[model samples]
Target: MPRLSTRTRLLLITTFPLLVLFVTLTWYSHQSRQEEVRAELAERGQLLAAALASSGEASLMGGQFDELKASIYGMMQGDSAIKRVTLLDASRKPLVDVEARTSGQPEARYFEAPIHKRLLYVTGGGDRNVGTMGYVQVRMSATALLAKQRRRFYIELGVASLGLLLCLSLAYRMTDGFAASLKSSMQALRAADEEKRRLLQRVNTAVEDERKSIALEIHDELNATLIAVRLEAQQITALAAQAQPAPLAGQIGDKARAITRLALGLYNSGRSLVRRLRPEVLDMLGLQGALEEMVNQYERNHPDCHFALQAQGDFAGLDGNVAISAYRIVQEALSNIVKHARARNATVALLRRDGRLEIAVADDGVGFDPAHTAEGIGIAGMKERVQALGGRFAIATANGTRIAISLPLES
Candidate 1:
């Protein structure tokens, strides 16, 4: 099953139980209403039976059939709900039966009561009950009663249904509002992230450009001056060699040689600085050639540590930004391995597959815990550079340190 969003989950969680409760309450209400109607009908029927029995007492005892019939008819006319009236003698035999026939069986309520007569003395002081005269049976139609109950039930059900809908709608609206707010927050975060990436990209580009400019200035001005100074020192040393005073010539020649050595050291240091700022080979030979040269230099500098480079693909088509980022990533990785990774050999692989360039640098080194160690400027710069070009940077230190990057060729 597909996962549900917060809104959907909230809707189901809130509404399902309410739906079950609504159904249960409705059923319960219907049952209670039915029972109430039945009870009311039964009570009404009993009261009607009692009233008829009281009114028809004298007629029943006197055997006045016409009078009893008149009384029953009058009562029936007064209330249309009285469906049938049956008067019976002491033995349960019908004396006078008057029925208002209805269409259905067990469709109306029925009630019966006994009729009794009391004896009076000649002195006008009334006495007690003497005999049982007869009984009265009344059948009451419940159609009107049932109709009213149904209307009431319908009204209650409608109100309940409306309430349920209102509650559910409110819940839905609340969840939807929450979800909208959450979505807005997420969009804002993404926008901020995009802006941060753009800013970092611009910074990296400016810094690289400055480094290149400074390298060119140093190479053109400072290195040229040092070369000129070195040539003059050598020419002075050659001229001083033919001087007549042996000690003076030896001292001057030694001084000139010393000056030339100092100038030579300064020139070499300047050149090394230029290379550190920006390697010209990167521009001349492309990313692959630059990486090979860098690896050779690293091996030379760290004689104990072995370095190897393997390259495959048309790196010529790679974008400049992507190439630089890849180069820098590899450069930083190797530097870290040399500084921290206490191991012998490192491997650098550059491959292009499916329109993207992949670079992996791994070393058989004592890997350090990434969580415990903070990344220095070099590692951080490499990460920022890769992200600036819309690429991925991943590093793992378990087993051995590995840094992997993938960049789109077009980008």
Candidate 2:
């Protein structure tokens, strides 16, 4: 069977037993009504027999058959339900028989009463029957009793049906209210989730824009100033080369050289910071070339640790959003490895597989348990960024730590 909703399930659970109870009660009522009808008819029969026996006592004793017949016929006329009224002698012989024929019907029910004569003296301080006179037998048809029961059944059926309908209506209203409440709650939750996603996406875009702006300022203004300072230092060294006093000239030359070295270091540091903020190469070279350049930079910076990049398929057509997320995720993973993983080697893999772009970064390092370690903001931000692009992000650590993320090729 197909699944039923809460309303339907509740209706079945609550109403099935009630239906059974209704049927049982209806049957009981029918049986009780039948019994009552039979009893009422029986009582009426007994009363009529007793009355006829009393009235016909003298006629029966005096052998007045005509008088006995007249009394029975009179009673039968008064009550058409009385099908037959028979008077019998003490020897059970029928002296008078009066029957009103009801053709084409089943045999009527019979009720009998014994006739007795009172003695002149009472025994045990009470009236006593001295001798048997005769008996009165009355037969009654069940049609009238059946008719009463039918009417009673119809009335009971109507009442029960009305009660059942009322109960079902109440149950339906209750279930409808409950189901509606649940649906409202679910819709509210869905709306809240959608709003949260939109907010996160906006935040990610704003942060990226800020990074790009800051990177541009550092690269264009700060690096230009540092380069000018280095050039001036070189000019001062050339002037000191021809100084009058040799010692003073050497001292001035050394100072100028030191200034030049310091300026060069500062300029290199600023460039590194700018690259970390936003690699300009990412915009110029696309994801695959930028990733390869990043790997080469890492290898040159940390020659003690091996770094490798393996990229398949052209990433020139990748969306800007996906490219940035992928690059940032890989950058974060590599930063983590450099800072924490006391490892000898690391690998970055970028591949297009099954219409999706998959990136995997692995390091042969002293892996720490992810469950025991709290994730830093960088990792959390990367996860959010990947998810914002409708991608999956996951990290695992065993013999080595591995971070993997996948984004749909469409975006």
Show pairs that collide, candidate 2.
Answer: none
RMSD of 2: 12.0
Worst 10 residues of 2 by lDDT: 100-109
**Candidates' C-alpha lDDT:** 0.85, 0.85
Model 2 lDDT per residue over 19-101, tens place? 99999999898888888867877888899998888787788778877877877777767765677888898999998888876
* Span of 10 residues, lowest total lDDT, candidate 1: 100-109
**What value does the lDDT take at residue 371 in candidate 2?**
82
Question: Could you tell me every candidate's TM-score relative to the true structure?
Answer: 0.61, 0.56
Candidate 2 accuracy as lDDT: 0.85
What is the C-alpha lDDT profile of model 1 across 1-411, one tens digit per residue?
899886787689888999999999999988888788678767877898898788788787677879878777887677556678899888989988987654423444469988877787889787778787888888877666677888989998999999999999998998898878877887899898888889888888888899989999999999999999999999989999999798999999999999999999999999999987887788899999999999999999999899999998888867776777787788889988988898798999999989889999999999879799887788788888887777888989898898888876674
